[model samples]
Target: ITACYCFGALLLVVASICDLVSSIQLGQDSGAVLSRPANSSRIFYGVMFDAGSTGTRIHVYTFIQKDPEELPVLDNEMFHSIKPGLSAYADMPEMGGYTVRQLLKVAKKTVPRLEWKRTPLVLKATAGLRLLPSEKSQALLEQVQDVFDESPFFVPDDSVSIMNGTNEGILAWVTVNFLTGHLYAETRETVGILDLGGGSTQITFLPKSKKTIGSSPDDYIARIDMFNSTYELYTHRTCIKYLLCHVIHRPPYIIVLLYTPGLEWRVFKSSCLPKKFREEWSFGGLTYIVSGKPDGESYVGYKLCYQEVLKVVKDIVHQPYELKDTSVFYAFSYYFDRAVDAGLIDRTQGGMLEVRDFKKRAKEVCNKMSKYRPINPFLCMDMTYITCLLKDGFGFKENTVLQLTKKVNNVETSWALGATFNHFQNLKIHR
Candidate 1:
């Protein structure tokens, strides 16, 4: 049985690789023009599904390879998204499969009818599914597989699976770099990536200092070969949702244990929340009654909020060496959304801001919680938490400039494209 699973996995990888290479080869005869010969007008498509914590997005990419010697350039991408995520269907696996089936209709309409069998379809679930119980996750995946099996498009055995947190960061890094043209640049100039998702956060970058790699935990440092360049990448999962917000309910004694066990969970408190506010929050199938201290003392400003969020991050997050150095970082997901909500950046066209900018904004937001309450109840807590995550968690200096963006060159800034690139590179089809 184990051997069967391994063999199935191997076949799945080979299928994905072949699907990507065939697409590239299909467009090799043409370099330009719409009035080209039938052979020269060959166009191929690839579909990638990003099942995130917040929503499920489909990226229908069209690629044309003018020269076989050069990498295929992305011609266009048709993107669409639906909310509530596949993880939200943990109990109703059939409904989750139905969601995927609904998204497949978009791909069917986007790709040529004759190309349905040739076009490859894949879905990569993120931390949302990872946070679910193993059984529930498996059931959801199985349902997705069933839906794929029923679809007209080519579905590889590994078409649907939960992506690793580390690879999540790496793929996002590749997508941003590729879009920014850094991946194919002559020099090794690359920007770092900080992705803050609801269920997890990822920090990935190329380390310039030897101390950064040497001091990091063995697993935190990963080496990946891509774009014909081998890169030693540093990834820190500490900022992940696993530890970031687990502070609210932890018992004082097990505070050392951190993320207090599920069985021991009780009413959680933190200054990050409004002093008089208390609510029930749900995540990963678990609900917690969380609130600020019930004591008579009123929580006034970011001072207390900062300290509360700090305990969840300080000392636990690794400080990347040479962080004071000016290196461009593209932060997105929750980071982008929060910045937009906080009025730090434009929603349509993102802007640049510094690490200290986030800190300062967080202080202002938290201090004026009452004023912003109508906009978002958790504005203060979320801002303060992100502030601490960047400054204390990442050890970034106040002046560290980060480009907070949602897209680059009109392509949504996420890991879907990078994962697609990985599929394309893994293929080794000889003429």
Candidate 2:
């Protein structure tokens, strides 16, 4: 009996060894499959997430092998963002935790079951959390970490990290260059990138050139400088004082605007507007007009047009709307009027309206404004206008300049956040 038992144990050991070898071979074969020559079916799955002030989005990517030597193609991609807006945290602190939970839930729902365990997840937050006070922000981050639990689950951890505004601009520049196939094999030049986001805008100037090294083909050499300005116009004290006055005085114009059609109460809740506007409108029955409960479609175009008109009026009045300076407003309004004159937006019907000649009008406005002195000279010409000037005024090809501009505008959260995850993985492997 003892001899028989020993033989059985030896057989079991042999079976285990065979299983281990099979597993290793399987892993090797999978790697080989990924390395195969160009084929449509050679894609491997990956995932990325962008947690921003407006919402969190999870994007799944499938990479297809392009060739035996070249990097795989980023094939199919899909994404979903937290509904309504991620910026809810700015007004309703209590909703922050709930919003994050909902965001995670949506991610789990969207990812395929097979990929649920293997796909890499990247979580990146911008704008909203960055604006929070340090203590409150840390607490929010802690809550996120607790929820994610730092597990190597398909979802990334909740620890909040964001690229500086300058880096955001640089990433935009790189993305545009890659997309347009304008990434030169050899050239040296400085490119300025500006990005306008829902909550903020970033400006970055990058000096770059391409150098050809033997056998390596060509490579880019780049240096970047970044600058960021908050959208909030008033100082904390001034804002508080404004809020207090608004609460006490209860401006008549606010009531009139709130109760009117084409000017929904919900406009007050817009993140683009200041907090005082939201609070005042919220209390003044503006919610009912904005909600459009009775007629869902009635407020659609009207609401949008009204918002644009209101924005123009605010510009005309020189009222401080965050990130929207008087100059920007004037440029936008002038563009809208030009659109109206050009039959883009009907001038006869005077409700909320859309402008057609927006780009042209803005350019004209900027050109005219440039003649006058200004506080920040750069404000006279935004990234778009500057690109136009480069193309038209400096004899740069429109297509080439546009290629660069698009690169500066295409900012994807996944690519930026994924680099961080890759670094962490390398550290873990070495350890």
Question: Model 2, 368-396: lDDT tens per residue?
Answer: 33232132222222222233322232222
lDDT of 1 by residue, 309-403 (tens): 67766666777876768488999987888888899999988999988888888888777776787777577777777788777777788788889
TM-score for all models, in order of appearance: 0.83, 0.44
TM-score for candidate 1: 0.83
Candidate 1 regions with alpha-carbon error over 4 angstroms: 1-40, 239-265, 282-287, 293-298, 428-431
Most accurate candidate by TM-score? 1
lDDT of 2 at 349: 31
Candidate 2 local distance difference test against the native:
0.33
Q: After aligning candidate 1 to the native by TM-score, how far in Å is the CA of 149 from where it should be?
A: 1.9
